[model samples]
Target: MAAPLFLLAPPRSYTSLINAMLGQHPQAFGLPELCLFNVPLLKDLWIRASDEMSNEAKTRQGILRAVAEIYGGEQTAATVKMAQHWCAARQELSTGLVYQEIVERLHPLVAVEKSPSYTISLERMQAIRAAFPDARYLHLIRHPVGQCKSVMALNEGAFALYVNAIEFLEDRAIIEPQIAWHDLNINILNFLAEVPPELQMRVRGEDIMENPREHLAAICRWAGLRDDDEAVEDMMHPERSPFACFGPINALFGNDPNFLSGPTFRPHKVKFPSLTKPVPWRDDNQGLKPEVLALAHEFGYQ
Candidate 1:
């Protein structure tokens, strides 16, 4: 079995675009956010959760679309139904096994994937290492201010609420976004410590967006894939990924819903926000939390 590549980050990072681009590499197979780790059982994915928000449901869309395209050769309702059965047949297997099966099916091409939810817990990441001890891990980082802003923009920060993405929960009960940024990133940092440096790497999302061709070539090199002009050309068309657009109705998402609506990848410069400034989300121009600032410095923001 091929050693898989996993992109780890909190949600709303430029993970979708980066993962798609890397997947489009001639020697790689980018996959949708399978989100398999979120649940222990495959049926749990289809089981209606109490949250009722349907966010988890979006995770299935990628697999459905990929199955439709890779196996069924068309993304139609019927193909999506076939994808469901495909998942059903492997309902009892571990997520890592299922992913390996998919990668093997695409033989010789490296499987590239990013599932932000994997960062929610360290144990989940450990499970990945245990599954593919030789697997390569990419610890993709985004500035807290930028990441939190993007998170808040999506569904009015419903994801933060969903993940209980709170940082400083003092006895007085003041909820702070800065703390959320600091702590969540800290979670990622600490978890990454256990991963061997040889199998792991890090990249700033902003850098990739600002200088895609260069940074993408760097990423390709890191992943042991070809970084020639042809590979560079293929990476430029992330929009060409099968999951770049809306998934078939039966399996509508394994990616950002916003991306599903408009998943075009255009190269553009990204501005890094000043950490010293007050965040725009709060009614008041509240500055970042002290802890958040400390964490930002650890991530080399200072």
Candidate 2:
């Protein structure tokens, strides 16, 4: 079995679109946000890991959609129901083992997946490495300003709150998405320190969006896959992937809802905001934290 390729990044970092595009490769299979490693046992997925968050049901949808598509050859209400049964049968198994089974089922075709939730904790990432030590990792990054703004735009920064990325001031605490952006990237960096250099890579989301063909080809070459025109052309149409669209009613989401609504890829230049500018989401006209700026510089952002 070909070891899977994992994309590591925080939420709203172009992961959904990029994962779908990579999956569109003929030799690769793009999976929705399996989020399997977020818990130890398969059954733990059904249990809310935190009282602060209540989106456990959505996280399980990816595995269900994947099982439905891979086993039943389609994603429908009936197949998703069957997937529920599949999970129940192996609820006691380690999530690592469960993920390996899925990878084995797609042998010879590289399994590509990314779940932003995985970066919330280093332990979840460690579990992934334990499961597939030989797996390749792509650490996808976005500009702090852009990423934090996008986070705040979605559900009023729910993800930041879920991760406890809050900043306490003189009298009150405010949702600070930049903290999440910085901390998550720090988590990814610390984790990647343990991975062999040859098995890992880093890329900016803006670079990919601005020049997908070039970046995608480079990624393909790194993974030992064909980087020919034909392969690159196929990757251009991420919407063609089966998981690109909404699944059955029983399992409606396994990825970012925005990506599912419009999986089409359009090449365009990405605008980068000034790191020192007062953030739009802030009421106090505060810019990025010093640590956040330091990390942004490390990521090659001005």
Candidate 3:
């Protein structure tokens, strides 16, 4: 079985677009947010792990779509049902085993996936390393301001709240997305410390948006994949990916909804925001925390 490639990044960090783009490589298969590692066993996916978040069902959608497409050759209502049955058969197995089964099915084609949810905890990522020790990791990053702003824009910062990215004042608590951003990136960094240096690579999301072909080609070369004109061109069109759009209604989301609606990639320069400026989402007019600024500097962001 081919060692799969995993994209490690916080939510709203351009992971969806980049994962789809990398999957478009002829030698790679892009999968939806197979959030399998978020739990221990396949059955745990069905069980609600948190009362704070109500979207447990959404996390399973990726595997359903993946299984439906891989086994049935399409994602449809009937196929999703088939996927459910497939999971039912393996409910007793470890999530790593289940993920390996899917990767085995995609033999020769590198399985590429990014489940932002996985970044919420270091243990989930460690599970991936335990499963595929030879796996390649791409540490995708975005400017703190850009990522925090995008986080707040989506569902009123629900993900931040889910991760306990909160700040308590004298009276009330407010969602603090920058905390999630800093901590998730920290989780990724700590996990990568155990991975062999050669098996990991880091890329700025804004740099990729600025010049996809150049960055994609670099990634292809590092992954021992074809980086020729044809392969590079194919990677530029993330929209061409099967999972780029909404799957069957039953398994509707395996990715960010915004990306699902507009998977098309247009080449443009990404404008980064100032790190010292008062964040737009905070009414108190405070900027990023010192730790966030320090981490952002480590990621080459000003």
Worst 10 residues of 2 by lDDT: 47-56
Please give the lDDT score for candidate 2: 0.94
* Alpha carbon lDDT of each predicted model: 0.78, 0.94, 0.94
TM-score, candidate 2, is: 0.97
Give the Å shift of residue 225 in candidate 3: 0.5
Clashing pairs in 3: none
Off by over 4 Å in 2: 49-54
Q: Is candidate 1 or candidate 2 better by lDDT?
A: 2
For candidate 2, lDDT tens digit of each residue in 114-141?
A: 9999999899999999999999999999
Sorted by lDDT (best first), the order is: 3, 2, 1
**Candidate 1 lDDT by residue in tens digits, 176-220:** 445556555666778778878877888888888888889889887
Off by over 4 Å in 1: 49-53, 167-176
- TM-score of predicted model 1? 0.91
Off by over 4 Å in 3: 49-54
Superposed on all Cα atoms, model 3 deviates from the true structure by an RMSD in Å of 1.7
| TM-score, model 3 to reference | 0.98
